[model samples]
Target: MGETVLYVCTTCRRDGDDPEGPRAGARLFDALRVRAEGAVDLRVEPVECLSVCKRPCTVAVAAADRWTYVYGDMDPAVSAEIILAGLAAYAATPDGIVPWRERPTEFKTGVIARIPPFPAPRPFPAGTPEAAE
Candidate 1:
């Protein structure tokens, strides 16, 4: 399986947070980075924004040929472990689809979207009539 990337939105700040202070997303990224140290198959990245402005501390997990997941409403102080657990479950799967019961509670409830893989699979075999049409 390809490496899984965890993208953290660094510009997200919770409501009422000081404008000049460190963003909650940045803190969450830092926490995840620290926790993920020595991990080989997972990479943590910080992005400027994920376009989920209303939900501070947003994050996404993706891998080649696998579904991508966006999760929001994370709390920097407590969400790292939960995110890491979910990431582990995701990496264990061939198509990035973790079983609903195995997913962390936050992941089950905080999911913003689940995007299909790029170059989506064809509905019919290449030599079939459907493919010819």
Candidate 2:
């Protein structure tokens, strides 16, 4: 399997936070980076925005030929370890579909979206009637 990337939204910030201070997402990214050091299967990246402004501290996990997941409402001070644990589970799976029971509590509850793999499989085979039209 290929490396899985965890994209952290660096610009995300909670309401009422000091605008001049570091953003929650950036802090989360730093935390994850520290914990993910030397990890061979996962790469942590920072993105400017995830477009979920209402839910600060957002992240996305993705890999080729696997499902992509976005999660929101993360607590920057404490979510890094949980996120890493979830990433480990995701990396161990063949198709990035971690069993619900095995996923971290935060991942199970904070998921904002789950997208199918890029270049998703066709719903019907090329020679089938469904594909004829």
Candidate 3:
């Protein structure tokens, strides 16, 4: 798996209600990428539809097959921090549980769906995952 793992909803707000669907998700992802450097395996892909339009612009982090976290309603301001925390959790464990309380509040319960990995657009970081830029 890449250094940072990210699951992006391609058509989150397909309906009329989801204005901030993929577009907002894209911005958040771009910012996260800039902050993540390369050590964190951060892969952003648009999924067909996560089926949770209410929570448009969903984001997830999957690693070790044991834990996959899903979070939505992502405001760009917090996205970078969220991604970093998720990466830390992913890196902290052989599984992907960074303690119960320590886990991201949105993903504390876990993600809604767990899809397959992408082909590989952006490669994983070679060394340590840097802090957000």
Candidate 4:
């Protein structure tokens, strides 16, 4: 019932443009993380390049068993709201599928593609357990 959000830079900033080289994604991720710290379960990460150049800063979310989507050209100011809303929707879904009508069109419009859930994680890996003896 948790989610991980990733803000991917579709295009690296032009040389000498921002000096920081496409920081909107970073800024957005940080804002969202702080806002969702405890109210909800969410994780934010930055990715190298998402390849949607024309759009610039973009973000995406990957849920346990739902459609993976990408949102492009997002304004840093509203990134947190977008992320929090998306997380809420994902958590509410019984099977992690947010209906088309329910999705935020503002963000969903940039969806590059849909992907299945990522590899499952082991509860307790070898050498790491509840009671090691």
- Candidate 1 error regions (>4 Å): 120-133
**Candidate 2 segments whose C-alpha is farther than 4 A from its true place:** 120-133
How many clashes in each candidate? Answer: 0, 0, 11, 0
lDDT of candidate 2 over 1-133, digit per residue (tens): 7899999999999876678899899999999999999999789999999999888889999999999999999999999999999998898899999999999999988999999999956588789998988
Model 2 residue 30 distance off true place after TM-score fit, in angstroms: 0.8
Q: Give TM per candidate.
A: 0.87, 0.87, 0.61, 0.67
* Whole-model lDDT, model 4: 0.64
Tens-digit lDDT track of model 4 for 29-133: 667668777774566666777776666557776766666777676666675787678668877876656888887776567566667776677566557654363
Q: Which is the winner by TM-score between candidate 1 and candidate 4?
A: 1
True-structure RMSD for candidate 2: 4.1
lDDT minimum window of 10 residues, candidate 4? 8-17
- Candidate 2: 10-residue stretch with minimal lDDT: 120-129
RMSD of each: 4.0, 4.1, 12.0, 6.3
lDDT of each: 0.93, 0.93, 0.62, 0.64
Instruction: Please tell me which model should have the higher TM-score, number 2 or number 3.
Output: 2
lDDT of 1 at 113: 97
Candidate 1: pairs in clash: none
